[model samples]
Target: MKPLHSKTEKALAAFACICLSAVLSFSALAAEKTYRLTLAETWGPNFPIFGDATKNMAAMAEKMSNGRLKIRIDSSNKHKSPFGVFDMVKSGQYDMGHSASYYWKGKVPNTLFFTTMPFGMVASEQYGWFYHGDGMALMEEVYAPHNLLSFPGGNTGVQMGGWFQKEINSVDDLEGLKMRIPGFAGEVLAELGASPTNIAPGELYTALERRTIDALEWVGPGLDLRMGFHKIAPYYYTGWHEPATELQFLVNKRTWERLPEDLQEILRVAMRTAAYDMYIQNAHASAEAWEEMTAEYPDIQVKQFPDDVINALRSANTKLLANYADNDAQAKKILDSQQAYLNKIRRWTSISEEAYLQGQ
Candidate 1:
């Protein structure tokens, strides 16, 4: 009877070992499987700095994940809908997107703050706020409700105020004038009685050239030189608005959740690095482009608005922001946070960077 019992126990143990081995084999197969994600960017195909950021992110993710993660990017030209990025990603049509946050302000008004403000922090200051301050949490609150996530993708430093057909000598020059602008800057201009409009990137040069639009602010010299705006617009104004225009990376909540823990970390690190790289790349490109423009384009005169005109625009911008803060609880919180941070950080900046630049 003892021998019979031992034989039965041995048989049961062998069967259990077979099942355990099968489970281990399945787990290994699942772990080794690859995940593929699709990204849609708001830039045209082969676009310089902006497009390069997305490509860099994808490359890093694949390399870090050891080929278990792959991302395919489709530029605006391929997707055929530059402004539809937010909606498409939200609807699961695209796993991720790269675009400026301010572009969707019409649909999500609170998004107006994330890109940049007329009198906001510079690139270094804003990056500190995003990584060490309330910027990330505030951004998450704004985007999470929409089943999406947003991160700082890149910064264009200070944007060129714009290329104008006429110099803005006073507040009177802006009144009743039509221009191509976007984001909160447009609202600030609207407060000053300027008719501000947004045109597609591809149409900007044509619109301004043909008098369809009086002026347009695309980007700094890094990109503007290629647009040929300098050839037509004689007065290239220095930046007042969009001091630090930071583009964003948007991810579908579902897509993010589907990623493995390791891959998710890899993606986050890649995006962060890519964004920082873009800031450097833009600085280099802008320096090079400005050198070229000065040498070749003698007609391109860089001008700053008069003090009075600047004061009026600043007042208008302040008024509009105050009105927005009064109207929305979230807006007020974000504005208050940003203002408070700027107040604290600007002192350090003034003593350090500002003083150094002045002495130089």
Candidate 2:
């Protein structure tokens, strides 16, 4: 009886050991599991500054996560939907997206506020709002219901107004002027009797070359140089539309939830770093491209909209913004927040950067 009891105890010990080993193996497997994500970009493959942001982000994320997290990018050429990035990511067709938030304004009015606004803050001031003030919170309020998270992907520090087939001398010149402008700026121009349209980046050069569109505003010389817009349009107007055009990264809520805390933090760091890098890169590239453009295409006339046109645009902008605030309580909140912050920061900016530039 004693020997049989000892044998039974030994069998139970072996079974316990096997159970522990299985649990340990499962845990190890779980620890080593890899998470792969896919990103869709509004820009086509090998696009310059904008496309570089996505690649920089992905490389940083993968390296930071030690290969446990991978991101695959599909540009517009592959997806065939430059403007469909928001929908694709939200619907889980893609895990992430790189596009501008304002592109979705027609679908979500509040989204218009997250991207740069007409006559709004510059890149530094806006970045201050995003990282230090109410910007991120307000953005979340707008996107939460849609099950999306939005981050500042990159900034094209003050964009050129656009390339115009004809110079804008007066408010009358804007009448029936067909231009490729997007976001709130388009609405502002529309209010002033101009026809505003949004065209994909890849299609822009063709549209302009063929005169399907009269004018288009891409980024500054950094990007516009490659598009060969100067060859078609002579009058290159200075910026007012997008003082700080910020591109966005959209993450599906489900995808965000699935990421481990470490990976989530890694993504945030990667995005933030890439965004800053793009801003600097754009500045550098624009400087170089501007030099080359002037030397190569001396006839590319750089013009600023006349005082009357500027006044008219400002008036239209104010009225449209006021109307939006009156119609939507959320719009009111966002506009008011931006205005208040701008009022506060502009004072300091005046003393610092603006003052220094004037002295120089």
Candidate 3:
């Protein structure tokens, strides 16, 4: 009987040891995997679309990862200059960054397709171009040469032309005007007899205030109001140069590759969500800002350019497009591809975007 009781005790001990080992192994597997990333934006917190959606994306990414992957977002000057952020990410100086795609035109001429073009697709159409058309794949191919991965981060829909101190009555008014604009718009502005300067965001207000620049064009009403351009430039102009401006997020190819598949998918979803949020928020914010500015800043007059002025801009834009076709092969490819896609999608906008706006 004593031998049998001893045998039973030995069996119980062995069973308990097996259960403990299993629990330990599972705990080790469940250990968290944390990752850190830096997202940079050119604008401040009040800039609406880009800033607001970026914060939300970081928060949502953190939440979706369930503590397994932790992301640290430094929105305002935490990492680098707005334009500098893209290079930093491409070189692996930072894990990721956010800025408008046109900022890096020198690095990737095709990048402007992802950002914005003169009289190109709207926010929704641009989104469709990326997701449904070959836009994203083409963008990835363009970024491959730069050692970076790029995605559409946000959009401001159709942006305002810009704020002008003087009313533009004709192409003659653009002559010798020092305008703070960038991307293809700068090229067109030059064609239209204006000296287009690509000033950094922080320096624009000072440049305009010091009389170094005759006019400046930032995002739109909400963002421009924050910068207090209304006080300085009474004549507000339209952003016919930039019908729609899209923002981008760039990640180092190596760092992006290192991410687990699930985490990569999480990032893609987060970016799409951020873009959607940005467009919606900016539209409302611009309206609110316009209302506030009109009520408060009576001296700051706002008026759209006359038909003649718009017609001059249109002619300049056509000349710019022709130049791109003649001189830039990559630019021609992007323009042709984007236009082809738009031809197909613009049909739907009649009922979608156009009809809604007309009803309003």
Candidate 4:
């Protein structure tokens, strides 16, 4: 008869083979399903970062899901206006959309907090709050009532204030300044005596060039380059009312739920990665664009708003928050959560980001 040791070795080898078979079987099962999703964007093929992001997101999703999921991106012209994207996603008109949360402030007053706060967190801090703090949950809570799932798409860190037809010498200069501003920031602008009008991206240049609006704030240097604001508007200002302007990817709740588990994970991971790419790209591109703009157009002047102007905007933001809290439960919740998260993270930021910037 065979020894007991020999028999035991055979049994252990058989167990190992069974485990390996189970793993392979599960992998094969996961690889069998396919999901097709749509991602809508405002910028078409020409905008480098936006287009690259959309393409990269699609590629990453497919790769991550092992070809089990594929995303097809449609530009704004393919459907209704880009500004209408949030509503379309909410109404299940599309599976996903890439846009700024602030654009939908009419539908969800609090969503702007996720994109930018008047005098709030910068890009790194915003990302910290989003991934680690309560930012994601707060944003999701605000969008949930509207039948959407929202995630951070990207950020244009600490944007250029905007282009102005004339100098903003003081708070008083803002009075009756017909400008294209959106969301709660527009409310803040209105509080400071400016008349804020909501204008879509496609129409902004003509409006500014025709003197229909006195001022306009788009994303930053890279995006502003595309808009060619430098050509029409001579005065470019800094201390962007909407600092750290974030972009969000909004998806339909029902459509998201229909995705398989692996596909869902793929989408989540791809979006998270895309957010990082966007932040880096925007930051780098803004620097290059600013240098190019100043070099090419010596006639144009770039300036920062007066300290008094910044202070007045801050005060307006405070009042804006109070007004928001009075009428909006979700807005209040988001602000509260954001405030708490900021309080927690500020300690580390003081040492890490703030100190480094100061040293710089």
Report lDDT per candidate: 0.92, 0.93, 0.79, 0.83
Model 3 C-alpha lDDT per residue in residues 241-360, reported as the tens digit of each score: 666687887878898888888888888788778877887788888899999998998887667778886777778888878787789787787778898988998999888879999999
Looking at candidate 1, the ten consecutive residues that score lowest on lDDT are 1-10
Q: Pick by TM-score: which candidate is best?
A: 1
For model 2, residues 146-216, the per-residue Cα lDDT tens digits are 88999999999999999999878888888888889999999999988889999989889899888888899
Residue 337 lDDT (model 4): 78
Better of 1 and 2 by lDDT: 2
Question: Which candidate has the highest lDDT of all?
Answer: 2
lDDT for 261 in candidate 2 is 89
lDDT against true structure, model 2: 0.93
Question: Clashing residue pairs in candidate 2, if any?
Answer: none
TM-score of each: 0.96, 0.94, 0.87, 0.88
Candidate 3 TM-score to native: 0.87
Q: Can you tell me which runs of candidate 3 are displaced by over 4 Å?
A: 1-31, 44-48
The list of candidate 1 runs beyond 4 A from truth reads: 1-8
Stretches of candidate 4 exceeding 4 Å from the true structure = 1-30
Tens-digit lDDT string for candidate 1 (1-360):
455367779998889999999999998887798999999998888889999999999999999988999999999889999999999999999999999999999899999799999988899999988999999999999999888999999999999999999888889999888899999999999998899998878888899999987888988999898889998899999998998899999999999998889888999999999999999999999999999999998778889989998899899989998999999999999999999999999999999999999999
